[model samples]
Target: MFKIKKQISKLYMASILGNLSLTGAWVAILAARGYSLVEIGIAETVFHIFSLTFEIPSGVFADVFGRKQMLVVSSIMRVIGSICMICSKNLTMVCAAIACFAVSYNFSSGSGDALAYDSLKLVGEEARYERYAANQLILYRLCNGISTLCAGFALFVGYKIAYASDVLVTCIQIGVLLSLREIRLDHTGTDRKQEVLQSVWKELRVCFVESLRFLKKAKRAVFLMICNSFVGAVDIVLLFFLQAKLPQTGMPDSALGSSLFIMEMGGILGAKLILWCKNLRYRWVFAVTSVLVLCGVLIEHTGIAVLMTLGGFVAACSDDALQVRTDAILQEMFPSEQRATLISMESFTFSVIMIALSPLAGIVFSVW
Candidate 1:
């Protein structure tokens, strides 16, 4: 059991605020809106665009303006987007809401951690990265559990209550943002703002060139990113299962939350387990995924809810472990020149596949 440390201060708390609030309502809120597979697919498409377009830019923004400032802006955008989502009942409003949310996330995505990592490096705590990273995962899982559990309760109260809960979390995110300690980049009283226009152009150019270089050189690593994406896309198929079961069970929101809760909990165990793996890049993920796919097929064929749930657990653990391992590997190998863009592209490709697969999943579950 990793005890929460005294050194793990407000910065860690502040860093995760955005993800904590955003993760909770993201899936449940979409389901509540009654958007179909196609609509959800479109929303995911926008997410990919925002994520891809902003990935490198946001990191550059951090490099330029400092990470803490960008996070505040990110939280603000998320609040606005959530409000947009709450107001709209149709797919268009949902789409618009997604667009705003994507924009917000794009601006804030990779930068927060980059800022933290740099801070750690400055302090010569680079070796502790894995431990702290694992702790963050634990906190994420615990927070995710609480948030989704709250969403489940809110569903019993009403869908509006759930939406309201999201708004409140955004408020939490805002407060967390204000409390963050600001660190100046490179110990320079001379600010990145001095070279704003030049840095902007340089950033754009470097992002493009470096992203290409990473993709070209890191073939095996890139393969893992692809697998991560495709597996994630397939994971969304379980949503159709939840959606179809909801009306019949006489409560939809709670069912959706409970379904997600299972996966999140499974992810908790899977995340910490990554540190124990000796040869994750060479063996574990491929072996785990192959076996898990068999479980997926069985879950589908038998239509046993328990088996399906277990399948989700297996999938979540395997996927989460594989992703963390892959991300750690990439971070270790890639230089700052193109790290964000390469990571973004990997995520973008996955989101694209997820977008396409959502509809196919809808078709399959509809028939089943």
Candidate 2:
């Protein structure tokens, strides 16, 4: 048997490197290229549309091919996307870059946790998946927080320079992925061979059928999944547009990365706080944190940059808490067999909502 903890540690490192993409300045980069708010929205909408379309298919591919392989594919896509963003000078190229990012994200989403949980199960540490998951989330926010801070500093140099840094980090992440050994757990002797023989169309149908059956019994999880989608979509719009919105509140452009970095720092602390107080009920914590997030967003709408910055911090903290809680609950609700497929379904819902709402948000900003 392979070392489960060792694999988890490797995955954690990869997650950190993968997210350190100077993300705080993505919208700013496009804006710097002269893309209007509406055009930026259109690009995101295209991303969501392509993402929703490919999300499930990619998840199915992960299940059949192997999660480690899918992650490697994701890293490659991210590298290509980063290159596109670095070289982009117009709307078409930026949109193409966003599409690559969308595809890359879908490939990584369900597979990482599925791979981690399966590894734990293989080593008889399956029961500790919740704790393992919590650690992963903590690392994710912590890395993102650090990257955002650095990204702000990099922004002083140039937006392209920041994106170039992101590309280099992503390339290193691929090396991390290369070190992960793929674990194929097949009880039945012929499962792998059978999968190879099955047509792609058949695999798609099987994944869909199995997922629907599980969703039928897991109503609460289903509801949470849908709600998470809406919340996530709104959060994405707010996150991307936040830097742009700050100028109206008398905030200077140079401080945008710092503000975003601070907000991400708050999320890291919130995640750590959840780990510190593990006795808290997930349901109650999720409810309370979500409400706080809503309040923060509403306050942000008031056009006061300082208040908006504080609101962003509050929103980031609460949102991170909510995500940790939701991930735990969903882990409890679904068995390992269908975990990745179910998670992909949830992401598909999120993309659909973003596709519908992103354009409207763009229009409102454009008109303003």
Candidate 3:
């Protein structure tokens, strides 16, 4: 039990370290580099395209081999991505870098949560996974917020320096990841012998088939994933565009970091706030958050700097609240053996939505 608690604590530390990147405001950096909205949209689409392709396969690898292994791969990909971005001098190079980032994201997305939840499950503390999930979200939001607060420094120092700093942080994160203990689900009797006899391809095939079978029967899980992902995609698009849009509202470059930081605090708040909504039904939670997100969109379209920032904040807040709740519900529904793959499917859903939304949102924001 003590070791399990320590492991969970380490996961929290890893989350903080992983998210603390000097180049967190990549959209703003690209805009400052003079990329047009259409070009930036293309870059984002490139990312989701690779993400869509790799999400499930990466998850299958985690389930078949080990979650810890996939996370290490994620860190290495991040380092490579940062280096590529540092060397990038054209949109094509930027797209290549973004594809590396997408691969990094794919490897990490479901692996961490699977590792954490299974670790807790070993100790019969699975009920606490929701709290852990919320805390992880808080750490992610706060760390990313701090990184965004460094936007001015990142901008002043330039992309090479900013990306180099990210490489350094990722290296440290890799060291942290190396120290994590891998959790394996227990298989007994005939199942144990079957596991020993199964080839890697067989294991992967089983995990994939099981995940698909589970999803087919678990319609509620699929619905929850789609709804949560849609709201998240919308909020993310608004926040990403705000990095470029805020400046055009006459806000000085000096305040850009602070504005973006303030907007991220909404996510932190939402993560915390969802814990208080334990009594609310999932339907009510989804409905309310969806409406709030749309309200944020309406608010952002006003084109006033203050209102737009508020819009980003509201959207982020609502998005995180729904995300935490949905993750908790889905984690409970998933079987341990197929956990990571199923979660990756949820991410696959998000990537699809992001691929569809990002380009259109970019053009609309660019025109407006």
TM-score of each: 0.81, 0.90, 0.97
Model 1 / residue 201 / CA error / Å: 2.5
Per-residue lDDT of model 3, residues 1-368, tens digit only: 23887898878888888899889889989999999888888899999999999999999999887899999999999999999999999999999999999999999999999999988887778899999998988898888888888888888999999999888988888988989988877532011112563478887998899899999999999999999999999999888888888888888767888889888999989999999989999999899999999998889889898888888888889999999999999998998888899999999999999999999998998998
Top candidate (TM-score) = 3
How many clashes in each candidate?
Answer: 0, 0, 0
Sorting all predicted structures by lDDT, with the top scorer first, yields 3, 2, 1
State how far residue 221 of model 3 sits from its true place (Å): 0.7
Q: Per-residue error at 200 for model 3, in Å?
A: 1.1
The true-versus-predicted C-alpha distance at residue 33 of model 1, in Å, is 4.6
Stretches off by above 4 angstroms in model 1 are 1-8, 19-34, 178-199, 236-259, 279-281, 297-301
Window of ten residues with lowest summed lDDT in model 1: 185-194
lDDT of 2 at 33: 55
Winner on lDDT between 2 and 3 is 3
* Pairs that clash in candidate 1: none
Compose the digit string of candidate 2's lDDT tens values, residues 1-368: 57777899899999988887665567765665577889988998999998999898888778767788889899888878878877887788888988999999999999998888778767767678777776776776667666655544655667677777777888898899889976655542112222464487776678678878888987888888876676666666776677667655676666776777777766766666776767887667767777877777677788877788787787777777667667767866765556677778889989989998888988875655
lDDT values for all models: 0.60, 0.76, 0.90
Of candidates 2 and 1, the better by lDDT: 2
Candidate ordering by TM-score (highest first): 3, 2, 1
Choose 2 or 3, whichever is better by TM-score: 3
